[model samples]
Target: MRRREGENREATNLNVNSLETLVTHIQVLSGNIADLTYLSNVLKQSGDWLQSEQTRLAPLLGELNPSMHSLGYLYILEAHISAPISKEQANELLLSVARFINACTAEQIHLAPEKFISVCRRFKDQVLLLDEPLRGVAPMLTALRKLQTSCEQLTALHPEFLLLCLLSKSYKTGLSILEDDIFDFDQPHDLFLYCYYGGMICIGHKRFRKALELLHNVVTAPRLIINIAAEAYKKYILVSLIHLGQFSTSFPPYTSGAARKYLKNFSQPYLALVESYDTGKISELETCVQTNKDKFESDKNLGLVKQVVSSMYKRNIQRLTRTYLTLSLQDIANRAKLNTAKEAEMHVLQMIQEGQIYATINQKDGMVRFLEDPEQYKTSEMINCIDSSIQRMMMLSKKLTTMDEMMSYDPSYIREAEKARSIFDFDDVDSLPLKPDIDAHLKDVSSSYDIDD
Candidate 1:
């Protein structure tokens, strides 16, 4: 009886733990692309055992090439992330992972996304450890393209790739990704990194309005942590002063409680300068800047602070545009507090060249004449701008309508809305759960991009 029971147990163990069985099962399961997600769940459920089976790692990875068995290869790679490796082995692993990421079947990998992002993150860590961020840039960009169903989709890759770009000073390439309006994100931290890094890229380009919008996203996003928000608020104040020519003393209503209370404590110098800006006196702004010059230098915002000081002169000159039709260069300099008539002429010429103001400066007489904005709203460029604006609005409206329809089908969403309806004076739209789908719909729109491609 004991021998019979032992034989039965051995048979059961072979049935479940046999490598041949798993290999055959993976091959058959991978044959049908549609079953990839089920395979992913199976791997996810077995992740701990897989992680423990480091002895079988070689044979398993050898049998599962990424091109033929992308899901299996990815799972093994994910498992290997936690396993120990020497520096030399890690360098080789980096190359192998990059190859797997580049050559793996995207549709298969996307279905078994359980560890694809984590694996990508490991690749980034290896790259950073090697101190070759530039080498990481192209691979990360490829990983992002492979993992996303749309270029606009935000993932953990967004922040990592942006950091690589920032380190490599590939600002133009980074800006390319930022052109897409990212409404879909896997995590709030991803969104924060996207906005914060994206804002810095925009600042590099001197796209101040776009920078302000991105930085504002980080500042106002509802988060328990305040470190990133505090840094963003510092930039936000400087960008507001530079781009808008002034900062608003009124606080934004939607800012989270943590941000409202703590961000101010770290950014007192910036806020004081805003007060100086409000006084509409360059001398006070100058004094504030000089007093806090070391702080600004430590913050690496000295350049922007100088621009703010210079912008005050421009703003003061622009105000003169409203009140005076004409003024001699010396008079303009005195009013705007410039050092000389030549300096006043230079500012006017730059402002006019930039379409910030309409004016003509006569070098002969040193007189400046301010005129109404000369834009006629009739140029081909203006018409194209208007058409593009209208098209973007229409596109956004359609997306909102589609999302609303999607939410209406979610049972949890319906229950939440019903609860809201049961409450009195519930006018806030903030109660609804933000997007419901984690691995959202795939390449549904013909206009949409495919992960497989």
Candidate 2:
């Protein structure tokens, strides 16, 4: 029994030694993976061999402790592989990659911005291709934001990288950059692309008005790029339908006539849909959608078109409030082309709840009453407008005050102002004769005359 116990102890030691060896191997592999310069050199030497090397190293990373630096490098290497990788193979790795990026120090990102940005761009493309809801988008965006904060030069070099990162639910980051005019792009396409992404981000956050403004910028760029303008025009039409219940005829006056003509041709389906909606005829709109179903689907605009269709009843119902103080549910149903009085009542109720209409419902009488008391209807809105104006003024005042303080304390500005004042005084001296020292000048003249005598 003692002999057997000794043998078991020897087996345990052997296992311990094996574990240590495995850990050593993991450390070596992780270090090698984290070396971006080394990986870049490998790719430069032989791109084909990089893939197999990455494949071999990837499984070993799984065996070791998960780390941000190692995961980030691995993701970059994987993206460099020439062959298309399956989403299933990439999904788990991508989650780790996102976490690693999010946790990276500003210094680390600054040290290796090219590698960091490459990972971000590749991850964005992969997520888009997967056609899945972005799961770790926020963290990835945070990582990109950190990189931008640390090294603005990266953004100047690859504005699209930061722009794509902002497209992934990073509206606050995107908006801050836009408001500050932080990006400097050498190419016009970059500016258009920035506006395009900014508009989409606004749409995601339900800031429809802001979205329209950004899209308008893209559509009306001075040197209009047709593809960007066409795309922007599509969004502009949909957002207009949602915001105004019809298409807008007023486009930017500065837009070229030729560009306007091309947009009209490109946006025919949307124009038809808008016209159908404007007629206040649900059947016409439905028929129009059905007829252009193939076109809408081909343009990938069916979803937006359907939203416009759904809003048709609301517009029709709203019209009735303007004409009638009170209307029976059945009348509303008939007028709005809804199937039943019950459906009409529900639509009205929803509109009322949303403050779209100043109206109340009478369940017993099955009637809807429009609130016609101007005071009651308009007072709250007036107050809200006043409050909003005050808030805006206060914000403006604060900004101006801050500017004044900055200017007042600027040493260089003060020095320049003093220099300008001295120059102005000298100019005044030059313009007007100065009074001479009279006594000294008279003595000098008398002495000169006495010497001559």
Candidate 3:
């Protein structure tokens, strides 16, 4: 008992009386304290003690292999950031923490979640403060990937990581995270930010369909104010115009009343652009864009608005395909409102190259021959794609069945259902309709109808 108490006391004594002794002291602690839970609890409980020793403790954390002493390093790092530090020192710690984060053992880090969260939030700030925030992208992503228990579990880090990716123009890295279906999350705000930033990432990828879907989620998701959703709604309008070539004036029935009322007022310019785009007149679209040029530029959506114009051109050209089997480039130029035959030919060649239209352009004759789609869906790749889609649908069906079963087994749902059934159930004496000589009446009716009695 005395020996064990001695060991416990020694573990608690985090004194670095001298710079020379700091490394030796940490080594002793790591070696003597065999139980990680004990070490984790000690570090957690003594955060104040650790904070006082921050000057001595900070250096030791960098010296220790984070994988070997994750709990101690996490707690110390959390303590180190709890107080303020100079910008110069923060830059230094940013590099240090990034290194630690990459090397930290995942299993041990989970032991002190509170400390881990603190360090992560601080790290995000440190990286964002750099002159070139893009430098933070790779490390932030690595940290997020490491810290999360599962890809499905959304954390506070999710929004910051996405912001870094956006700042760095790392859309593919952002999509790698966004592609995961988040089924578990503790904060509503985190979910909102995830959808918002994730939608922007998809837009960067020119994935208009996916971008619209994600932005729509932000708009319709239940909220009291929905400022983020309102911002997402503006982007939603632009994407909807580009992708669907039309926009609905009304919000869906499920959208919060606050969104429907205020969103339109805030984004009136974008809404007007929608109106002009619906005209299918390139001149009107261009005019609306020029009129709202300042607002779109301020919102950093000037580029996206330009894509809407190009999409309109493509849409106009595609319409011509339905009408004429073959048309000279000059006729296409006239009908599509393009300036010249060369411009029309450029559009045709690009569309054909993208497989957006099945057409052959005769360069010598300055004519385009639109043809029927050639895909017969007989290739092995097509078969595999179709089979995969069916499998996914089957999986979704099974998931829905499982969720329904789980809901049926919920205590609250079961209780409410029982209450409803009991309240609606009728008693024989009180509620049953009185039928005097019902059997005789039935027999008489049957005889009257010439049925066998």
Model 1 C-alpha lDDT per residue in residues 326-366, reported as the tens digit of each score: 99999999999999988988888988987899988887888
- Displacement of residue 241 (Cα, Å) in model 1 is 0.5
Q: All candidates' TM-scores? A: 0.78, 0.59, 0.82
Tell me which residue pairs clash in candidate 3: none
Deviation in angstroms for 359 in model 3?
Answer: 1.2
**Candidate 3 overall Cα lDDT vs. reference?**
0.73
Question: For model 2, how does the per-residue alpha-carbon lDDT over 189-278 read when each residue is reduced to its tens digit?
Answer: 556666766676665555778888888887777556565567668878877887678777656677755566677788888788888888
User: Which whole-number lDDT from 0 to 100 does residue 174 have in model 2?
Assistant: 50
Task: Please report the candidate that would top lDDT against the real structure.
Answer: 1
Please identify which of the two predictions, 1 or 2, would achieve the higher lDDT against the true structure: 1
User: What are the RMSDs of all candidates, in order?
Assistant: 9.1, 23.9, 17.7
Clash count for each candidate, listed in order shown? 0, 0, 0
Q: Please rank every candidate by TM-score, starting with the best.
A: 3, 1, 2
Native-to-model Cα distance after best TM-score fit, residue 30 in candidate 1, in Å: 2.8
Candidate 3 C-alpha lDDT tens digits along 68-91:
777667776777777777777778
Clashing pairs in 1: none
Model 3: what TM-score?
0.82
